[model samples]
Target: MSNFNIFLKQGTCSYCNNSIVIQRKHSGENLCPECFQKNIEKNIYKTISKYEMLKSKDRIIVALSGGKDSISLLYNLNIIQNRTHNSKPIIALIIDEGIKEYREKSIKKAKEFCNKYNIEYKIISFKDKIGKTLDEIINMKRETPDYKYACNYCATIRRRLLNDGAKELGGNILAMGHNLTDFAETYLMNILYKRLDIIANQYFFKEENDEINQFYIKKISPLIRIPEEEIFLYANIKKLDYYPSHCPYREKDPIIRKRVLDFIQECKKYSPEIEFNLLNGFLELSKTLYYHRKKKNHSLCQKCGYPCGNGKICSYCSYLLEFS
Candidate 1:
């Protein structure tokens, strides 16, 4: 027996009798590269099905960022779409937050992937919509009192632009590439700050209403069950031409979200399934909160007609006013 085999007596894949290439710590399953990748795709399909995230006639808009998670998602979804009977081609929506060199590099990779696959794509920018680049926004607001982190501004602007852009492309469903780690981190952050309303807003199975649908595209994260590291591995294994760098603001910002993510990572060392636990907790809590919130009528923004809590203006419109 080889040294590797000797080290792991059960060195064969759990799904098949092939040499194991990766062992999933969460499930304690050893799998070969082929099987591992297959498992990831299978998980994605199952997540969509379990959540009822897609309908046959729904126009799909994939939010492609050219990063590992988003690229892997687009590749898998493309394959699935191709296999579906008489399904519409998925459109890729790329949002350029105008972070200078950072966003340009990713946009290049995003365009290349879309062109190579012959997928239709639309690119929107903060400059065109918000009237300023993120760099410019930060520079203008950094010294102001009550100035939020760059991530705060970027996320608000990007979310509005992505939703509007997707709707403009006539898409009813917006597919996101957020992985398990992202979900866990966000949920933890919300929990820390007692943001139950945000958690409630993310409930997976909300009945479709025309009023809400008109303003907000139905967003789905098919990769919600997959881990971040696994997505990175899958992207590399598939040899995807992805931009491997993160946004500069994400690393530089001393945001609580970053600390929460670090805490999650630290907990993962002792508890491999920590993220899964957090996700499950979120699922149950969000479901309960969703039904609870359903009793009250949602307050729509006076300007945009989107939900804005008790306020007359939504955060998106509020940010626009600030920029204006």
Candidate 2:
């Protein structure tokens, strides 16, 4: 046996006798390249179907960051949409955060992928919509009291822009690329901060009243069950053309997101199934909180008239006002 095959013999795939490419510690499944790819895609399909995240006629706006996760999501969604009769065309929405070298290169790759696949795409920029790029926002907010980290601004603005962009394109559902790692990290962060309202607001099965259904396009993350590294492996094994870089600010900022992610990784070393546990806990906690807080009325943002949770001004509007 060759050296590679010898390595494979140590842990052959659970599904087939092929060389093992991935060892899923969380589930204790050793998967080869082909089986691993299929498993990831199958999980994505299952996630969407279980959540009722999409409909045959629903227009999907894929939030393409040009990263591995988003690229994998867009590719899979395109394949699924193509096979479904009467499904609306999947549109790739690229948000340019204007992060100098980082976003520009990613946008280029995004455009290339869209062109190659003939997927219709739209590009929105922070400069055009918010009158300032993310870099500018960070610099401006540096000295202000209670100033949040770069990620705080970036995530809030990017979310609002993606929602509005999808709505503008006549989309009913917006698909995102947040993987299991992201979801688990965010859940832990919220728990650490005692942010029950945020958890309640994110209830997956919250009743969609007419008011909410009118203003908010339902958001779905099909890859929420898949880990981040698996997505990276899938992208590479599939020979996908995606930007292989992280945002510079992500590492530089002293943000809770990074710390929480690190903590989760550290915990995973000791307990392989920790992330899965966190995800399950988040689901139950969010559902319970949603029922308890269902009757609570959310105030509209004074400036934009959008649901602003407990605050009079929404975070989106607040950021815009501060930066403007």
Candidate 3:
């Protein structure tokens, strides 16, 4: 037999003594393919149950980008839904940012995956909704004095699209594929910029009021506990047909989010549990901040009737005005 086959056959799983297929460095666990897959699925299930993320009556709108993290999340959610009694329907929502060569391929994969699994899906486009593709937005704003990065524009528009699409579809919960690394990186970015309002708004444990529920669908990230690399591995091992490429703008733009992610990865070299620590800190800090600000009344945006922090128009509407 070849050396690769010999290596695969030699080692046993740390938990089951079955032949190992994956060796996790941070956890120091050698797992067989079956065990690794099962462990990931179990973690996702536990995350949902622990956070009360889903209810039987909730219509879940999955933000499917056709990437590994999203593909894994959707697949696991389907499994969980299947095992439950009277499970709510899951609808895959895709936002086409209109990036040439990038979004087209991913959307194709997303449609194929949804079709193969018999899941209902909807597609909305930046051109249709915002009157501009991401490429056009970048070109239009690149030379402006207060020019925002491509990621900023992309995230802002995509978030609004997802929320509006889900709400229109009568979805009660919107599930995203933000993994552990993303959570950690975002937490650090908020801290660095001293954006306490953003942090408070993102507090996961806040009691939902009518004003909040009316506009914002409850958002959940069941993959938040799992690292990005692990999700990539899981998607590949499970033979999921997912888009392997990332957004072209992500690497090219000098965004702070990329820098923050790089910093977290560097810290992981010296301290393996740094990401977990950041996540824990975020949980505590967000809870404290939420309680501190919970009593403050939220004003509705004049244009969209969504909850706004201070201004009469919500940020989404404000951005829309800029494009108009």
Candidate 4:
């Protein structure tokens, strides 16, 4: 034998010794690539059942941004809803944040997915509703000292639109594509920002009352136990044609949300259970906040007739006035 061995070790799947890229344990099949996709869908169905997010009469409106998470949510919800014999069907609500590059691409993907699934879809634009798109508002505010960040504008507008749009479409609840990692990151961000009310409202699911229910739509996320990476993988394996670009504003954000995400990523290095622990943190913190803050009675927003606090104007209205 030669002193130096020149043979390269050919790698195979650890589970079955079949040549493959991924080696993780899965639910069925030889599970090279296509098989893993099926496993994710099955897992999503189980998660939905375990959480009881859906019901016989729920009209679920999926918030589809054409991103990996939203596409995965739409796909899985479409499958599970049909099997449950749910009376109310699921629809997709796509909100365009007015970024030409981001919104345009995402809208195409959203329309495509909806077409393939034969699901009802609607698109709401900032320009049509607010009289100005992000590009217009940014240009107007470019010379001003009070230039708001992209996420600040995008989040405020989208939240209001989805709630309003879902209600308009006769939806009983709004389903979002938020996963465990997203929830954990958001939870930490709220703590850093001292947004107690947000944390209180962001518990796993919220019950809709006549006051807030009329103004804001009830929301649920069945994928909270799934990780972000898994969502991406699931979407790809399902051959979901999702908008593959990130919002330009994300990198531009100098906010703590990004840092919080990084912190979660670092913690995940040692233990994959960090996300589940953080989710537990959210559950614990939400109960604490709910107990501390007295529930406020809501009235209709004079402008839109949605549920509002004692104030006649809602956050969406306040956001609109910010531009003026």
* Local lDDT at 320 for model 1: 83
**Top lDDT prediction, candidate number:** 2
In terms of lDDT, model 4 sits at 0.76
Better of 2 and 3 by TM-score: 2
Per-model TM-score, in order, reads: 0.95, 0.95, 0.94, 0.85
lDDT (CA) per prediction: 0.88, 0.89, 0.87, 0.76
Clashes of each: 0, 0, 0, 2
lDDT of 3 by residue, 1-324 (tens): 011221344588988978987676678788888898899999999999988898887889999999888889999888778778898769999999999989999999999999999999999999999899999988988899988888888898899899999999999899999999999998899999988888888877668788678777889999999878778777877899999887999988898889888888889888878888998898889888888977888898899887787989987788788888
lDDT of 1 by residue, 1-324 (tens): 011221223488998898877777778999887888899889999998998998878789999999988899999889888988999999999998889898999999999999999999999999998799999989988999978989998988899899999999999889999999999998998899998888988999888788778889999999999989888878876889999887989888789998898899889889999999999999999999999878777888888787878789988888888988
Tens-digit lDDT string for candidate 2 (1-324): 011121233578999888898787788899988898899999999999998888899999999989989999999999999999988999999999989999999999999999999999999999999899999988888888978988899999998999999999999999999999899999999999999998988888777788877778888999999877788888887999999888999899888888898898889889988888988999899999989988888899999999987878999998888887
For candidate 4, give the lDDT of residue 30: 34
- What TM-score, to 2 decimals, does candidate 4 have? 0.85
Cα lDDT for residue 193, model 2? 92
Candidate 3 has what TM-score?
0.94
Query: Candidate 4 residues 237-307, lDDT tens each?
Result: 56788887778777775866888888998887777688888888888888777656636555777877766
| Full candidate order by TM-score, most accurate first | 2, 1, 3, 4
After superposing candidate 3 on the true structure, give the runs of residues whose Cα lies further than 4 Å from its correct spot. Answer: 1-11
Ranked by TM-score, the better of candidates 2 and 4 is: 2
- Once fitted onto the true fold, the runs of candidate 2 whose alpha carbons sit more than 4 angstroms away are 1-9
